[model samples]
Target chain A: MKAIAVEPGAGDPVVVEKPVPEPAAGEALVRTLRVGVDGTDHEVIRGAHGELPAGSDRLVLGHEAVGVVEDPNGTDLERGEVVAPTVRRPPNGTNEYFERGEPDMAPEGAYLERGIVGAHGFMAEYFTSPAETLVPVPPELAELGFLVEPISITEKALEHAQAARSTVHWEPESAIVLGNGSLGLVTLAMFEEVLDIERTYCLGKRDRPDPSIDLIDDLGGTYIDSRETSVPEIPDAHEPMDLVYEATGYAKHPFDTVEALAPNGVGALVGVPDDWSFEIDGGRLHRELVLHNKALVGTVNSNRGHFEAAVDTLASIPGWVTDDLVTGVYGLDEFERAFERNESVIKTAVEFDTR
Target chain B: MKAIAVEPGAGDPVVVEKPVPEPAAGEALVRTLRVGVDGTDHEVIRGAHGELPAGSDRLVLGHEAVGVVEDPNGTDLERGEVVAPTVRRPPNGTNEYFERGEPDMAPEGAYLERGIVGAHGFMAEYFTSPAETLVPVPPELAELGFLVEPISITEKALEHAQAARSTVHWEPESAIVLGNGSLGLVTLAMFEEVLDIERTYCLGKRDRPDPSIDLIDDLGGTYIDSRETSVPEIPDAHEPMDLVYEATGYAKHPFDTVEALAPNGVGALVGVPDDWSFEIDGGRLHRELVLHNKALVGTVNSNRGHFEAAVDTLASIPGWVTDDLVTGVYGLDEFERAFERNESVIKTAVEFDTR
Candidate 1:
């Protein structure tokens, strides 16, 4: 089997050969179809984030995976069924979170994410996973099934953001996505298509002739150049947002999101920032949060329910938009192009086999 | 009528004589019986917070009042009925928040809090308010009805906190109250009597012989001396908390509360901090919030629903607990004693008349 592997504390990823493993009882052998490359993947490759499997010199590098079951191995799934595998798994046997079917809520030591943490990922030609971790995908949407993982991240984040405002009669009419990345564009689409939010805004540092910004415009969202209008200044520059969806890992966005919120507004923070310390008006931020009934909910990863929701979101998004969003799809021999960062690139994937 | 008034940027409050107010149409004239003194009152007295009404030279100082309606002024409220007036009112005309009975969610310029912001309060011998703003109280609970205002603050905070966890199967077993002030003690009592949490803890800086510490002990809550175990260290020294109720206005506690949370834990912030800038590891704090599914909700003031819930909370609390919590009750001549902070003081109030 050919696999994409990254050596921790080393440089970029490399293609390597490995033996195919047989599925154990209650496990399904999945033939990889497409594996998505995201910011976390780049971080893992650069040794900035993620961990290699224990006692292993290298780790397989893909968490956003979609495949067809090559062998059901006595599980309920059909052999040809398309599926996407969830990332987090119980580290030292089962814990309470996995027991509740919410591995996303597991604490640090209790769980590890495949491809991004302590276990090998699905970037290989073939991988075996516990049957319960596999979420079935409609065969008609299998070509775009890899998108389920990224969409699920937004699904969980928005779920919590809505939960924070549930006590009040909150109908958020306006929202702003704090980044113009691939995930941010997808989230903007979800906001417009799924949530039906009236006003949508996307913030990016790119000037004119940017594809992501164009995607935002195609989705009928206003794009605010980050250089011209910062997050906190958005209320004065445009309008106070009813919801702030923060996907930018910039350390200052969270504080600015608080200032950008309208009364009873909620901010959903999904970006994981690096260790950085800076000075901010702690008093004003704290005061705004308390007095205005504002809330900030931090979220990461996703569970099976979110994954299921993501499939529906992906189906609802226009095909032209997804075509533009996924700018690159490389084969196993050309995986390097999938990880490239260019001004025009939005999302990229490595295909091991066609669905 | 006699009232406690404070001049903006002045030294302290002073007793002054003013004409008794007349209730306008759709208004109620009330005779103040008891008004509780809190941190906001002291802040107003020291000119550290709050604004005077338009064209007024001094601002009256008290928002937590229990009174009997002297005149209903053609409204539905009956004369001689015990009532408590909600703090916030429309600054100009009715805004969305006020119209929806959620003045607590109104933005800064949209509403003003009586005795706390740009409006006159109920510390006077007599006061007049819009009939709609007063919540009728049972006469039997009127002796401790003044406690409703403080209890309402916690009521709203906990409501939002629970809402943040509504999406998950969150059954918080252990909790911590971040201050031992009157509001914190009342909140601890509510946790034991109302919420029925199994393990409760209260954090304070008080040394031995402190009445607040004794009160916490009586409520079956563990008291953590802040000087010994800081907020961030609580998880390691004691245990990671499922719920953190913050009443201390220290600038750094919000960040610490994030670190002290257990997996899927939530913190409710009610204290308003002074303007202060400091450095902290923003990355770690942001990461903790995302990975652990923890949440922090900031809340202030209260509405009619919260006040009604607070009345129930006050009634459910043990009478001896309330008796010990209110350590001092000063007459009009000894009003200054009610604002004094000492080792033995838990709660103090100014009594203009008896029930």
Candidate 2:
């Protein structure tokens, strides 16, 4: 199997062949369909992510994947049942996050030990995972394999947005997406699903007349050229914002969202930035950061429940998306091309065939 | 009547004669017994506070005071009853706090008014206020008439600590106080009232072994001389603290205290500074803040419910207080001596009817 591995710190990634993994006790083997490329994949490959497993140099990248069970299937998973693999699996096979009641915080993130940081990944023909994590996908999700992973990410993000603000029922006055990438577009999609936001603003360079911009318009999210407009163009620019989620791996996203928030507005950080050290004045944050009392939270990878909810959201596509954000689908052999044009591809998935 | 007044923009304070105020409908005439002199009065009288009302030069300066009712012989407040005046009145009141379901944000604060900033205050022979603002000083409060307002501030801070943190119980692993002034000591007392924190450290200096330091020791708090020793002297100074309340009107206090918070520890900010705007890195705070999802809060003033809660705590003070915190009493004419060497007087109250 061929895997893309990155050396520590800003280094070029290398493609190397590694041995395929065998299912251990309580684990199951799967035949890969397609792998999804995301911001996290780019981050891990650049060594900017600290959550990377120890000895990440040997890590196999790619957490967003779709597959079919090849070995023993758990009660929830079945052979030939296509499904998006859950990224949050307890590595020690125990409840490491029992205290926090969140699974993504498990010391062993899904990326590591298997294929992310220290483990073998699914950019190969075969992948093995804990039986408990191998949830079944509906048969209707065949051609839409790798895309499910990205959708799941949005599910996790929406879950996070709801938890930080209020009950999921409360919609913000307006929603803003700092970037226009596939994840950003998807984030808007999910936000529209849960909240009755009066308007959604999509911010980023509209380099060309693309479908994403059209999708943003279709979703009722007005496009904003961040380069031209100063703040306060919006009604309550410096006031409390009901909700703001950062999907860009850019470090400035948090600061931008924090400044744009209204009092008691909640800022949810879902993007994993390339820079590890983030600095700001504690005094202002203690003072102005919370006008009427707002919250700033980091929602990393989702737990199983979030993934499950993401699936439900996926099944019910809001009226906005017309399949514009998802563009390319590739085989495992196109790993190099996947990374070469990651930015251009809204959502590219790896499709696998099992004989 | 003799009153204290200051010019605008950081000027000198002087004791001058002023006209007596008349009671209107729903208003009561209070003959001030002991006027409490704390940082608020010091700041207002020096014209260093911002919330001052325009043309505040004719202002009578004092917010914390114990007084008797004179208007209705048997007004809502008895003629001989000792009480604290709730500086904020309704409609056009400086302190805009009123309960709608619950009290919203504090109105423009008590000190920023005419006698205060633009409004006249109580550091005089007589004062005018609405009948509703008087909080009856319970019979059990043997002495320390003017300590009511400071105690309310402390009570509000503890309530904030309770509301923002995860646990409802005050007795977390331990609690720490950032300063040991009147505000700091009162905060310590309020915390002790709620839970028996394993160890509460009081960090500050005393002119002659500060009165608050002695009270902290009596209440089982370990006092630290922050002026002499750096905060790092304590073990795990970099770790998150169980609960830390910054009673100091300085940024450095809360910054250092935030470092000492244990996982999920909360730092409550009640202190307001004179100069400089505040800022915080939204990304770093979300990542490195409270490990168990910690939070930091800023509480403005006591709401209606908060005032009620404050009186409840004051009524339950043990024998330890009189023997420790309350050191000496002063006559109204000795105001100069009390304000000059106030540090020497652990906690002082004035004798109004010094006939």
Worst 10 residues of 1 chain B by lDDT: B5-14
lDDT of 2 by residue, A310-337 (tens): 6666666643362666676665566566
In model 1, the runs with Cα more than 4 Å from the true position are none
Per-residue alpha-carbon lDDT of model 1 for B231-255, expressed as tens digits? 9999999999999998988888888
Name the candidate that leads on DockQ: 1
Query: lDDT by residue for model 1 over A65-120, one digit each (tens)?
Result: 99999999999999999999999999987998899998998878888999988999
Determine which window of 10 residues in candidate 2 chain A has minimal summed lDDT: A105-114
Query: Candidate 2 — what's its lDDT?
Result: 0.60
| Model 1: how far residue B85 lies from native, Å | 1.7
